[model samples]
Target: MPASKGSRNAVSSAVQQIVLSPSDADYLDQLIPAIKDAAHSNRTAQLLQGLSQFADNHESEIEGVCNTNHQEFVNSVNQLLQVREGTVRLTSEILDLNQSIQASTEKLAEHKKALVDSRSVRQNIDEAAQALEDCLEVLRLTNHVHDLLATKNHYAALRALDELQNVHLREVPQYKIAEMIQKSVPAIQKLIAEAVMTDLKTWLFRIRETSQFLGEVAFYHTELRRTRQKERAEKDPFFRNFKLNSAMDLVSDETDEFDVLDNDEVQVDFSPLFECLHIHEALGESEKFRAEYAATRRQQKDLLLPTSIRLVGDDEGGSLSALLESIAGFAIVERATMKKAFNLRSTVDVDELWDSMCQSAINLITQSLPDIDDADALLKIKGVIALFIQTMENWGYSVAALDSFLLTLFDKYAELLKQKFSRDFLEIVSADDYMPMPIQTSEEYEKVVNVSWYTPEKEQSDISFPCVLPFSQMYPLCCIDIRNFLNQFYFFSDDHFQHPSVIDETLKKSLDELLAQKVCRLLVDRLSSQYLGQIVQILINLEHFETACVELEQLLLAARSPASAGKSVALNATEEFRSNKKTAEKRIFELVNSKIDDLIETAEYDWMAPAAQTEPSNYIQTLTRYLSNIMSSVLLGLPTEIKELIYFDALSHAATMILALPLSADVPTINRNGVAALALDVQHLSQFVDSLGVPILRENLDELQQTVNLLQSDNSDEYYDVSTRNKKYGRVDPMNGPLLLEKLTQGMQSSGRTDKYTTLSSRFGKK
Candidate 1:
């Protein structure tokens, strides 16, 4: 097996050597595989025999193949021989080229050494040339910048300075002239800034000169714009839709019209302003410029106001109008200047300038306010301020500051009116006589009613006047004064506020507080302290005052703004007036009771000695006469309820005093005569009270009458039985029967009739 493997390896080596092409090698490799397969089958001899026969058959083809490969190998050998010859030739050329390159590098080194020796000198010469050119350019530009600054051409001067610094100076930093020019660059910039600012200042001065005309033009333009806008809105479908959908009605009913100013009418030169703005912007100092501009305008506006305020009228209305107009005019000019110069419609700095300008006028107005005392004059000033505010609003300026000022002015006006009304009220009340205001003629009566806020149920027919007037017309003179004051107040408020149905809530609240705290309180205090004797007249006056307060309250309610229409506002003044009326009424009863007390104290009864006819005592007669005098005098004019109350209380109090007299410690004992006198006085009181037509007063005296009857009776039991049968004497106690009988017996014994009283007591058995 080993010999056969060695034989196969030998055959493979021989075949690989003979087979030059890849395809012949592949065919020999296939023949090896077949010989291996034949050897495995023990047919290697047969396979070798077949291979020999195949070689014999293809000998010529094989020889031809050998010849072809040998010829191609010979050709490849010749090609390699040719390549070797070319390489040898190329190597010889490279050697020659290397020699030539070494010679060229030696020459280049000599040239580089020569160039290196002279390069700094050439660079120095070029630098010197550049420096010369740059110095000339710097000097030229510096002179040109100076000339531009001289001519107020700041923008061109700034550009030249920029060229000197960025282009020329950078190239020649070592040059002294360049250094000098660079050092002076800041100074040049400052010069340009100063020149621009100077131009601005001059422009501002020119603006000041033409400020009034400019203001008129601006106002005319604003009005024209507004007119155009309104016309456009009226024609616009979207605006029409908005108008139809909006809840608020149009503010004005008149046609939207304005007088258009001709463009040729006003010619303002804004070149200097524009130049200044451009220079400042180029300098990157726009904020600084704006601040300076605003400050300068503020100073100019402040100078427009007078140092000392002077009133042109009672409220300084005219002077205020003039000051506001000047402020508004200047403000308009400044606004126009801002738009033209800075192209700014509005800025924070500009708004601050306007605020400061308005503040000057506001300060003047505030200073002038304290001296003005009239509400009407304040109203006029308010109208002027309102117009100013409207004008400013139409000019597209904020009226917030002005609106606040108006509110403050309104407060001051309301306060002034309150003070005025309070002063008037005090004057009227101080001069009041607590007497019925006499209306002698129909004309006088009508005038009083008209002035006194006396609203009658119906108009009176024209007729002859009567001497006696109704309660409404019979109020004191102060009522008419109050009415006059109210009329003036309403007129002033109507004029000032200009609202259809409402005044300011703040004003209304202030008025209410003033009426309650000052007016009603003043009247109440005066009536309580000083008018006790004039109670009846005071009641009539209070009634009228209360009615006037109601009218005033209704007016205030009707004048409420729509926003506050549903809100409830309690008028303390109205209730105060009614309270004051009640106070006056209570004062009447107090006066009546006080007089009764005084009359009762003056009475000195003779309880033991008097045995005369059954007539009323001196105290009772005096009290009755006093009551009758009061009923005929002050009480006659009072209302029926009050009159009856006063008279009835007086009589009741008087009867109580007489009844308590006999039981007093001062009157230790009383006899039949004293008892009879007491009974007569009580009867007189009852009859007097009855005559007053008050049954309640008569009923109140029944207790005293019953005690009097018990005192006058001989048999206590019989009297008790008779009085018990009558409800008029029910106030007399049956338990006091024995005590009364014993007192009677003591009185009789004291009068020398002790035995008769003892017999009566025994008969009655102290029942």
Candidate 2:
């Protein structure tokens, strides 16, 4: 292949020289032009030539392509120019930033130098301030040193000290002065001892004289203390802290003949007078005794007064200005008796006079009672008490003493009622008229029962409108008087003693005079026969045993469900109870929070107004409303059951509703209710119970009279009592058992089933 190639190359070399010539190159170029003519001569050639020609004619295409290329080139150049512009801008920014960095560096160096200079200046100021503080401390210490250098002239030494240097001076209290001196300045104790010795030397003789005087003073103090009279001198601690010598020291004085100190060693027997304080107030001679007591008290007061007191040897007519020299002086005795009566000296603290009076009254009532039911007998007993009380007052008994005596009796009777009420199983006795206050309006009455009444003469009745309140109701008023009387003792100095003997004597004399006089005896006889003794005694007894303790509890609890019980129930507001109840006016409106004031104020005492004139149901309902709502509440708040009875109608109505529910409730006469009618038949029973201090119900059960005729026993009949063992407490009482069961069964049938309490059964236990 190489040889052939070489030969061809040799042969082609000659041809190549011919063809490769520059002229040949030019002829070829011309030949290509002639070929173009030939190509035009043939049809095909002509077609090819036409094409070439067309190509020449279509030069716009190539020119267009060239234009396109040029445009692309310009676009690239423009993009490159944009890139170059951005790079130049970036370079200029970098240069500016470098310049700014250099300036910041210079400023930073300046600021650092300034800060260092400022810190140095601040340090210098601090050093100056520290030096000033040190100077002040030095000055303070220097002043303290000056104060410490005290001289024998204590006052001068204090003045020489600098005020600012010794800013504080801590004083030792007297109690610790010795210890403080020993702790801080031991030499001060020696100086104190020397001063004490010097003081002893200067006042030795004077001290002796002073001691003698103090001994006399102390003797008086001893007398005062014995009678609690020292309270006048030593109202504060000043007396105890006094420099006076004690009486014992006075007694030890060396002087036998010329002793200045009083030897008050004579025993003073004040027990005899004090003993009189305990004497009974109602021995028929109460008036005489009270007078004696008053006089004795006045004398004691005058004798014991600081100005009146005289040493036994120093007086006769010397210093003794006799006020009540005799023990029978009225003023002294009266004051003492009054103190005991008024509770200025309480029964517990003063004497048994009050107790004795109470006992006497109780004994009279108990002894005089013909039967528990005989109220007339009770009235008689009351008359006696009134006689005793009034007689004492008339005989110069202190008003306070009389009041106290009455209050004691009232309280004692009230307690008796409570005891009886427990047996009757009554919450309280419900009556319209209480002992001290009576009712005004019959509409206010819910039931009917004869209230404890204080009837004045017909002439006095029209204008007087007098009412009696229960013992409890009267207590506050009485207490006010009693407290006032008692508080009077605060005005008396302890140096005085009150005597009661004169009052006793005066009271006895007065009684004798009254007894001897016919007019007074007639008055007592008339008043006593009607209202005084037996009736009140009986009422107290019946109330206690019949209705006070348990029944009241039930009534109160039932009252809580006002909506169920009936909205007319008088008690509405308990706020007063929680906040402490004030007067009736304030509590009445607030508690009811209704417009009942007009009705209450305008109410009339005409209980028998025809049913035709008034809506019978409405009247009954209104009456019930008055009773349950306001009156019951009033009674509940009071401590005495007797007051509750003041509203006799309300008491009976409520009792009828509660206790006599089993009876026909077809409203009978407007005048009376179930309990009221029962009370009429059993009025005497109250006296029996009162006399025995038992509940009427319990007593009646114990002595059950199968026949109606056997109910009342003669006065001489033997007394009997029933025990819970025979009729267990809460295990149905005989009188109530059958009725209660029947009522319960009826209640269940009438849709009155209860969840809390079970009804009694015939033969079952608690089931």
Candidate 3:
């Protein structure tokens, strides 16, 4: 656009000031759009006029700006010229580089082709080398496994076989040697397993034999240890004063006894067992191995139990103690073997194998129980079992099953003992002769006093030899039987009953009941109603039996365990004996009364005839002689008080018999002479009663004498006087005097003594 000089200069100055370099071209181009917009809108003149006014208004500022930017514009033109030169140079270099790159690419492709061909050969060589190495490794491992198997190193062979199959064989899958090794792997594994199982079987056999040897060794050591402990305890002062918690504590505290046998001589090899375990574990049959091991041991343990228990005295290991020791020794060895070899803490880990073993033993012992008849043998078995229980409990095994078995054994033993005692007592009593045991010599007396049940109240020196030996001195054969039975019983009980498991009180009670029922009561039932002399002897025997029983009761009480200290078991035999004694005494009196009745029945009186003699009747003489013989001989062993009682009672009964003779229905009437004979018999009876030295015996005899005296009187006035006077007939009723007078009158009339009878009747009847 044409403009003024100042405007043209402003425009030039603005152009120069804002020189459009390549970076400013965008700014100039941006302004071209606005300039074109103005031109197209027909605002070009107006735009020229606005620019002229802007150039005139700030001319100095625009010149200063131009002048300030003049050198910069010049530097810009030079830089642009330099840039153009550099651009031409760079374009030529780029063309040259592109041609070189194309040539290098073709050459690189040729070299790559050759390198690929060589790499293929190298890769093949590396693969062959790796395959060879793998084949060698598999062959080496296979040979090594065979060598291990040959050397019986089954566990190592199995491990090497694993490496060959899982790692080395994977490397050489197509190789013949690898294929052969792979095919043989199963056979090798099977061979290893079979070899391990064979070794295990051999180990089982060796263990079985070794267990027996070890059991015997253990038993020997246990016995030796017990002997040593006993010797030590005997020497120790404190042991005498103090008791251990249990006798089992002594054995239990010395667990080191097994250590003494852990030397080469006694130690068993466990290499085979460990190999079996490892090989089985590797073969994925660990559980099967455990089951097989357990089953084999269980079968072996079963074999340890006897089919039947041997009798105690039959053979070397026949005794209950020996058999139990053998069993216990085996159990101990087995327990230790399991704990050490298998790393098991207890038999509990193997499903309580030890308890199962004990059960087998218990069953065997129980099955043999019926054949054991001896109470002592049963007791020995029971003691052995109790000790076994204690030993097992100390070894950390459950004894509940064993404890139940022991209780059952105890019950059986108790019943057996009771039956034995009962049979013995019955036999002794049944065969006993009802006679005083003859102790004629001092030696015999000493033997009697020395019996176990004969605990004398006084010293032997102080005791005198009685005419008849007391029951304490075994006066009867049954007493000796009692002594023997008690001796045997206490011998069995002393050690057995002291054990905590036994109920001593119950056993003692059973014994008491047995003695009462089988001995004392038996004696009473069999002897109380026998003859008087036998009854007398039984009474004496019963007295001694009571004394013996009292002593036995004391012994039982003293031997009782402390747990039953509050309980008391009084022997019923003592009371039964005492009662039997009383029964015998009464029975003796009854027998005497019966004899008197028989004698009285044999007496015959002639009431209507004249008196034959002035002496006593034959019956009275026989009665007195019989009584004298009994008092002097049969009742001689009886105490003086009892003898006197029997004498007085017999005499009084005789007097009663004589008094009843005249009133008997067989005597229709008594003549004066016959009455005189009867009065004479009464007088003889009174004399005999007076001689007995018992005033009570004389009373009945005196009454009989007074009645006979009244009948013997010739005067009717005397009969009237005796009947009216209370002093004359103090033992007789005064009101019966008329009846007595009338009977006398009738006798007189019957005998033709009418004068005397009429006077007696006239005098007493009217009164």
Which model scores highest in TM-score? Answer: 3
Looking at model 1, the pairs that clash are: 502-559
- Tens digits of per-residue lDDT, candidate 2, 79-178, equal 5346345434533542344345445656877898998998899899897676556554544443443354332332222232222223322221222432
TM-score, cand. 3: 0.69
**How much does each candidate deviate from the true structure in C-alpha RMSD?**
23.3, 48.1, 16.6
Error of 1 at 413 (Å): 2.5
* Selected candidate, larger TM-score, 2 vs 3: 3
The candidate that achieves the highest lDDT relative to the unseen native structure? 3
Model 1 deviation from native, Cα RMSD in Å: 23.3
Please give each candidate's TM-score. Answer: 0.62, 0.17, 0.69
Cα lDDT of model 1 by residue, 254-312, tens digit: 25333221255656566777777777787888878776876787777666767766654
- Which ten-residue region of model 1 has the weakest summed lDDT? 241-250
Q: What is the Å distance of residue 398 in model 1 from its true position?
A: 1.5
1 versus 2: better lDDT goes to: 1
TM-score ranking, high to low: 3, 1, 2
The TM-score obtained by model 1 is: 0.62
